[model samples]
Target: MEQDLWSVEFTSLADAIRSGRVTSTELTELMLARIAAFDGRLHSYIAVAPDLARAAARAADAEIAQGHWRGPLHGVPMAVKDVFYTKDIRTGFGSSIYDDFEAPYESTATARLRAAGAVMLGKLTATEGVYAGYHPSITEPVNPFGDEHWTGNSSSGSGVAVTSGLAYGTLGTDTGGSIRLPSACCGLTGIKPTWGRVSRHGVFPLAESLDHVGPMARSARDAAALLGAIAGADPDDPTAASVPVHDYLAQIDAGIAGVTIGIDRDFIAAKATPEVAASIETVIPILEQLGARFVPATFPETREILYGWHTECSVEAALAHRATFPGRRAEYGERLSALLDHGAQVTAFELAEAQRARRAFNGAVAAMFAPIDLFLVPALPVAGPTLAHMATLGPDPDGILAVGPFNAPFDICGYPTITVPCGANGAGIPIAFQLAGKPFSEALLCRAAHAWQGVTDWHRRRPEL
Candidate 1:
């Protein structure tokens, strides 16, 4: 039972905790033990707060015993990316300069999760400034599925921990594909909520306009549950949207019957590997069988749109780090320093032009969604790359132009996007497909993903530790 507990999905695990079938303490300990056993090789965590987690779990167990049930997240054990500020906890932000810097206050997302009765196991590893492809303070997190394979960028440890069962679910920020790319590479379900849909109150920002906070989980249903708990406007974050928050799980099982899904075949053929293309082809028939109708569509030119995103993000990131970069320049990692150097060179006119292009791109995407319920595309162009291959790329180690174009565009448009494991390549590494929807349409996106998971076991498959 203890061994099996690690593999349980978030929803079922919550039910078990509420029903006394499992105690939060038991689950917490199990995960801690797993981390101790496996994380030396995985390097998925920056810190492990076993004492704090145990105390929280005990409190959750007492609350349930007293019949003060919180919700599905009550007594759930999870970890979050180190970018989210946790009060009194050292948040390195994957940099040596901030290695001893502890946050004075908690991020709004972590506070909400705590209120939901979730026990945080610790802080997971992240990239430098949450902008690069690798963590400079710690070893780059290894892919549990394959040692040589990439674990995706920025949210690398969040993906590793969830897939390896070190935690049930985790919060990861996506500026341009940080969340969804990891989900695709790790064979998990991840959602990048509409920009401003989730509060960025205390998160370390990469690109202010494009940053998003969302959940990475083992299944679409779990992602929906996590989104419900943390999403909504916060007075602390002026940019958080003042829109109605829907119950993401309420209609998650609703099938995508009669829903029109648009496919950009030209984009797929141009950017995707043959195996990834084949995996997407395989899922189209499966989705069609589940009653979804497919239609051909064309997206805005990828190069033009992504160039705007890059320019905007680079400039914003440079501004965010201006206090230290170039001044204390030697302190930053090689790749991040290079990026900041590039960002410092961006002219004010270039930033304004990028913003204008972004508005136009968002309009085009919104118009495209007018006729189709969702847009389906390959999440990553190929199976996960090797750390060595990524290293060779230097300053832009993420290879965004190759594996991330499908994801970055949605971030630029602030659209809700979810990536679910569709199938695996010939080597058994997972390949995923993304479903993007209109802004604030996370519930609808999860609904379609949940329906797909109902018929496929891809989301349920676990890596051999």
Candidate 2:
């Protein structure tokens, strides 16, 4: 059977539009139809903007017909995590409290995509306030691969939408592991850019200092396309770095020849499940065939840094929700309430000390990258857990702690990282490994990931659903 347009990468979809092989309206309608048919099982979308998407697609088609192609993403259909504020659209933040809240203006990330002529499919489901876990009151998105498997939190719907062909790509935030976790579990490529690489304006705050906005897509090149559209300094977000955005697609196909990929074999052997460890081990030879080399490297002791991450994130989250929590506290799920209550108790001095430790940890990790171009690690220590298993852990579970050992350190260190599907386990669940680079090294990361995808078909494998 011919693959659906929704399963193709955004780059391919854009090409089809420009070549007059398809209209943006046709593509948008196909995606909407897919959502109508299958999202019932995936539960990936919180809401579908049929009228808005159709209107936008018509506008895009008119522009392309007039030879006014905006760029690669022009007319491509995509969705965003519900945490992003979309003007006149219900920006639920995956919480019942804000379930009816619609933003007056668009988020910088979504606005940039819209400006690029991308058609919005709708808002994807997200954790409450894009925090540690799924919102208790909201319906959790099941993995497209299997309902028993985990979809990965916070950005769960974003992952499922991309993996199951509901959307070509979607935007997800990563304060800890939100982006990469879902990518790993759902078998997609996800980039968590260096801190401030993308604007956070109009995004619900999880942990302001640690928060990052990035893209999840079918391939590294697709992710690069999305990154190019959304990345850049935003005046509205004072924290958005003034760093010049690179043409991420420029070097994406450039093979990683002579590139030194650092691997901490001991770390993987000790921390990852045997299957995940073996899967990452398989990537070494494949990349070596593409002219890349590997060397031994060590990661900084993550225990202290992990603790500091919890402290800083909890305190910041508590402050972000202070006015609402304990005031209308019953409206929040028990786990989120507990987290807020815990954050309320963190002393001022403790927060100060955590910041100090965070800097030290960043410095230590930065030093590791000095001798290597990129460091590789498993995206998750184990295969994704089932929703039932996660349910037993309760709401407000320490998601960063539970899933972030391999993921959170980069957020703390503020380095760019990308997760690519390496392989799958016996049960058909996806397994992935991450590649971390120096700050603002998104181009290099994409290049390396693209090279791996070229040699392996892991990323191309989709769920039967």
Model 1 ranges off by over 4 Å: 391-398
lDDT of 2 by residue, 1-465 (tens): 136665767786667789778888888888899899998988999989999999999999999999999999998889999999998578888888886676978899999999988889899998887876567778889888877988887899999999998888999999889999999999999999999999999998888999999999999999999999999999999999999999999878878899898998887877777877887888888888998889999887877778888888888889899778879887887666777887888898988888888888888887888989999999998876666665665333354475668998899988999999987877788889899999999999999999988878888878887
Please tell me which predicted candidate would have the highest TM-score against the true structure: 1
Q: Tell how far residue 455 is off in model 1, in angstroms.
A: 0.5
Whole-model lDDT per candidate: 0.88, 0.87
Highest lDDT: which candidate? 1
The residue-by-residue lDDT of candidate 1 on 1-465, one tens digit each, is: 776799878797777788898999999999999999999999999999999999999999999989998998999999999999999567888888887687988999999999999999999988898876553557888888888888898899999999999999999999889999889889999999999999999998998988999999999999999999999989999999989999988888888899999998888989877877887888899899989999988888767767777788888899888888788887888777877787888898988888888788888787878999899998888766666776665435244555577888988888999999987766567789999988888988999999999999999878898
Please, what is the TM-score per model?
Answer: 0.97, 0.97
